[model samples]
Target chain A: MKPTNVRAKSLVPVARGGLLDRRSFILSGLAFSSSLAVSNAVASDKISTSKIDQSLPPWMKTPGNGDTEYGLPSKYENHIKRDVAEHTPETSIFSIWHTPIENQRGIITPNGLHFSVNHNGVPDIDPQKHKLMIHGLVDKPLTFDVESLLRYPMVSAINFLECAGNTAPNAVSLTPLDQTAQELFGQVSGAEWSGIPLKHILQEAGLKPTAKWVIVEGADGGSHARSIPISKLLDDAIIALYQNGERLRPSQGYPMRLFVPGWEGNANVKWLHRLEVTDKPAFTKDESGLYSDILDDGKIQRFSFHMDVKSVITRPSGKQVLPEKKGFYEISGLAWSGYGKIKQVEVSADGGKTWAIAHLDQPVLSKSLTRFYIPWQWNGNSTMLLSRATDEFGRVQPTRAHWRDKYASYSFNHYNAIQAWHISSDGVVENSYA
Target chain B: MPSRFLYPRCLKFMLSCLLLVTALGQVAAYADDATYTTDLGVALSPSEVSPYEITIFPSGKNLPEGKGSVKQGEGLYQNHCMMCHGEEGDEGPAARLKGSDGWFSFSDPLRVLRIDKYPILLISVGSLWPYATSIFDYIRRAMPHYAPKSLSNDEVYALTAYILYLNDLLAKESVLNEETILDISMPGKQRSVSAWPEIEL
Candidate 1:
């Protein structure tokens, strides 16, 4: 069945808040010229839909006409973009973000703006020439071209890939005035990944008894690599080639990426080219010194590969305004756990003083983002709102302070906390204390 | 009939004892280093060890020989650190290096700051780091994104000194050498917090 235009239809209601109104939002959209002119006149300073065409190169005049076998959202649908940036070059090419929790209804992120985290810049690779080599501690070293791997049976899973440092910046003491929780923790996203099971590849390579760790190396400029234990590879790893029902995007590891479910994002090596089984860790730079977390007591936590349980309230979070009303409002967010499934999520409308269990969406799969919603009536008084998540393992999200004291707020893994959102009597929604 | 069964049992017990004695003798010989242990029982010389085997822990024990000064580190910082971390180390489109009070600290109630209330040593160049080896290893392997693993050991040492100095943890005149690196203590060295939920953060 063809994909439905669900995004456009759903987004229609959101526009009603302002220019988001039906008539104005559509008319002002890049798809329509007349409305673009009107919107441009109203907001002269901002980049109007008409100006976008001028910024594009001639070859990109009709992004749709390229006749892609598998298409992404129309180029005009540019509202979705990466939430974070790298240190140098100031490009969001490798940047990623969690989907607005309240807005996520499906299993896959739209291709136009799927979250991405690249160690090096996204490399332009030709999939036709791509090949995977399995060597090292294996009994039979085998090389498989992309075509050969496709011949094997494939399985699809809806999973999320979260960077180990997804929320590192937010964990800091002084947040930038302009920064938001979404930008800080948004470097995570879920997708329906289609690929061959990693176990199948290891079997073909004839894994030796001594093979304890398998090192995955990417083809990016940094040659980013990491060593994962054999147990994890056989457990739920995937050599993902397709995302969201289509071939991988160039930014999301085009031909293939190693997807280690429920692990930190770095373990899910992108642009996968080689797999070398060995008796010990690869001691790659990413694992040994950088990605490793230095705990208290003068000891560094090494090889912390799993992302702990984490959840965040997306809407009315920060930089969003709420309407002043005494009526019922739906509090919604997303939660997930690396260990397993998310069993429950609790919401606090009174700065965590009291918590009410929120309703979770059905089919809460392991390592997948689960949608949650709670109905509440705003009393029109200034109050703090927060949401905490508890996974199946009974791991509950902590407060910011709780995470800081535990992880020392130094390294970025396992910073699961109940995010606080301050609602003012004036209906101003800002990130603040309870 | 009872005697016949007893005879077979005694014979079987004797055979098992003989096998056990042989196994014990073999183990003793292996411990004495008499046999060249290949796939069975033998110890390989240090030179015969795999070149890929290097595990750098947080302690300074595994550190390599290198010396760096804050003066030299300043030069490296200007060239490599200014763009992302900024000259003051407080500004970055990616992540700020200094003045991260509300960002990471939990003490500040404005929001859940990750750096607030964190032992400053936990930050780069601080006491929270258990090993000085990681600094040299990280800089030597990945830094200045454009050119990763390009820095020499000495250069990494210099950069490490500079970063530590920037965080105000190291003195300006302090010299960081492989021998004296472990002597430096981070502020969070004594703070032992567990990641487990029951530990009471």
Candidate 2:
């Protein structure tokens, strides 16, 4: 949907290149524009329903469309959708859909729009027939059907799931400058997931002292499997059954999926069924080849589950144009960490040269997306913009160069670097490396 | 009714005691505390779970039975995989399996020269996969792209053998079974390490 007009035309500059301290101004009862969200700025005055007569508008004159059992976003919101990034050459099923984070707000990703990468495609599983088995090196080898599994004590966690390969800055060929923040780094999304804490199941199975690793496997045709340490599963893992308080969408793994908070996404095996405890790491095809990070020394780095802190400016991102060449724009984006809550996010309008603190949206949940904002008065100049997020653990998101220096060489996965976007003098925004 | 009268009536008293015990037992089982274990799943026997134990561990655990020679694998590859994996396993739209070995050395880290294999990156059992068993495990789980798990254990072994043979790691006549596959030392076996020093974190 389109917006009427901006209300925050005058914001005091807090840093170089017209960066305004959004939190400070808002707290002091000063700023925030209503029309900042009116993207696709093809026309200045697209929709100003408020300016219409006070008596009635088009919607108010008639009864709304018949209600249905299931509801959907308004028809105007159809523009916001998950971008299908790529699939196996032509198979189309082995694919990855990028969440349009540019259009989304707040921490929880709508269940339907959550980013997904499927190996053998989304399986329409019958929850009635679905069963999760926890076996090997355990006193009791337990098989839990959906009914019995639901009987277990349930726990909910609001956490972010990020693909290991999300935002591989060095792999520019895969994600070019013409794309939006979602196309570049949409593999990460936040959600409120409710499920039985896996430790409860593991404890019931009676984990053997020798059980050091648990090879969690999906029931999908790909049999997508990963060797996760038993310790992590016991710590904060969940057998997630519901997403955003609803039965998980088919793509989100209906009935059940493994949820290892703060760990890499692939390890959270969707359509999860089996967990085999073992003494040593299994080094399955996924852990050994697919998700393994080939390092500088040519040695493969496996089980680097912790996703580092990262952020990206989604509003006015690639392909979007600023309505005015120079005006007040509330810069908005997401910052999150595998380590913990994002402590601070610094916005840089002049690339990395000048940095200013941006407001971390309220109730900054740990291991969840923290939306940040900074009201800026654009000077209509060709500028490079990026953000740096420092997590609670003191781990700051690194620059592309710095990250490459640390990891080095072939990166088929796990690259979190500062995403820079350029705004041209003509108001066109493009993904930037400058 | 008197408390003494209730205590004296054994039938009603026994029934009440049983109900109280059962309620207490359930309360103990489904406790609200996070630390409490529900012990709620059905225990299955090993034999019942045997059919689904598909995971093949690096240490050769769960490696299936049946054998296939590289010669047998070549024929099977031609029949099933050659369409996508290419006639020789090198020329394919999918991930190339076999290639002439000479990795562009990035020892200096700064100067990484792209030499030898270009355009199509080489990531196969011979060049990259740390374990030989994984080649079989993967082929068995996902192969032919169009039809997964359609291959019999022998066919999976056959493809694994052929791929290894194409990489020059195995002879044409060499056969691979559960035991033989374990003995085949892969080049990357020693080079793989966890990104985190401790997997616990």
Candidate 3:
């Protein structure tokens, strides 16, 4: 059956103050956007209307479209752009831009606005000249040009790549109470990446048994390189040449990138130019001096690769106004775990005092974003809202205090504590550490 | 067993035959013939290894032949690095690279004690970095920020030596080369270990 525009007809009245009853409240405001109306409509199993409207809206009045080679999102979505955060404005090289997570729908982050962290700035690479050299512990050293690598067997996997330093930049000290969801957790993003399975190429080169690590280096000005465990590389790493479905954006490594399914974003080196099989890590400056974190007692933590389970409530979060006090609203959010699939997401309306399980949408693949929702009824009183995620391995999202008690002294990387949003009596939502 | 139309033995035989066929059908239905191999991409010659593989390990196995002194390095640092890393290499438009003794004493006293014990957390070339060879690898790959990989082999070694000298890990007269870089001991070298020894971060 052809799809109809359901959003146009889903409008309902705004419930306010003490005037609303349970029955009336269920039929108004946030209730219209809930699953009840849509599920009821589907169960009826009838066309939207017995008689259709013959007249069409402006653009639809004539021929629907003239065929084009490429497609673009609707003009209404112009506001969906990556927001920039300048760590060092003097040089554009060492800066980060976060994906507008709240503005995006579903698990797939678009190619244009995928979160990017650059150390030495994005390079303008010539695909024709780009070559991937593999040597060191391999039986036979090989250099595969971009064209040659493309011809090899390819695989597609939908995975999320997150920076180890994703949420640390927006630590409580740096962000104000009115910080938006994008500002806090926009560095992580998911995409359907397509490329050659690194193992396939490595097999051809005959990887030596002694080769325990693989050194991946980018072609950017920084020549960004990181040593990855060979087991991780052989298991699921891909030399990703495409993002979503098209060529990789220049900022995201362009001609080639090393895409490790569930590792920190930096480990998946962009603009990949070389891979050296080695018995030990290269101990590059990035891995040794910069990425490593030190504890309060001075012991060092190195190679903290896998991102942990984390969740954040996006809708009705910080900086968003409720529009009306006591109105019905559906609480929604995104959850992900680098280890595996998100098993469950719990929503708490009264802080940690109580929590209700939110509905996890279907197609919950491993290491990809999982969307969750629950119907929340507001009482016009000041209240706290939060979401806590649990992954397939039964790991629960910890509170900020609990997380700090354990990790604050040692490191600032991998901050995945449950975020709380406070809705004041005046209908303003603000970030709350509690 | 009590069927009137057929004998019990006959019925049992027929049921067994039916079950066998169903099991075989399932096996056949699930079988896939897709091939996982593809004969694509070309191999490389052994000669390509020396020219393209630029990585320098902690063991100093693959370091190129080059030498530089603090005197020469200071000039290179001023010409290529000073604008971003500051003249003394402590203040920065990027990360600070020197002055470990007084790092956080002004801001927090506890930090001072921590640095006194394990100064690697201060993030300079001498205190935190484990291997001196990594200095050359990093400078060759990512340094001089805007013009990366622009420095010659000798220049990279010179800058590596100068940064180490500023941290007081190296003497002014010491000339750094591939043979001497790996021997240079860093204060944080003994404690620094790669491959994530800690489970939780």
lDDT of 1 by residue, A1-434 (tens): 34223223222222111112122212225456555443344545666465464776777785545478755655675565555443323352134445443334544556655666666788898777876777777766666667666655577777877877766655644453344555655667888888887887787567888888877877776667787888888887888988988888887887999988889888889899877787765445555434656544345565677788888777667776665455435666778888889999877777776676667888688889888776555667778878788989898877777676755444555556667778777767776544
Total backbone collisions for each predicted model: 40, 1, 1
Give every candidate's TM-score on chain A: 0.80, 0.90, 0.84
Per-residue C-alpha lDDT of model 2 across residues A34-120, encoded as one tens digit per residue: 435656756585666675566887788788889879899988998898877542332532577889988888888998899988877
- Report how far residue A346 has shifted in candidate 3, in Å: 1.1
Cα distance off (Å), candidate 1, residue B91: 10
lDDT of 2 at B193: 76
Q: Candidate 1 chain B: minimum summed lDDT over ten consecutive residues — where?
A: B32-41
The segments of candidate 3 whose C-alpha lies over 4 angstroms from its true place after superposition are A1-69, A170-177, A408-410, B1-35, B100-103, B107-126, B193-201
Poorly placed runs, candidate 2 (over 4 Å): A1-10, A23-56, A87-93, A169-176, B1-33, B90-93, B100-122, B199-201
Residue A293, candidate 3: how far off, in angstroms?
2.5
For all predictions in the order shown, the interface RMSD in Å is 13.0, 4.2, 5.3
The prediction achieving the highest lDDT against the true structure is: 2
Q: lDDT by residue for model 3 over B1-201, one digit each (tens)?
A: 111221345566755765798878743221112125353445678676667667889888679999999889999999988887767775455566665422474644565454433322346555667788888988887778877778999999999999889888789998998888877887766655434652221
| RMSD in Å for model 1 | 17.0
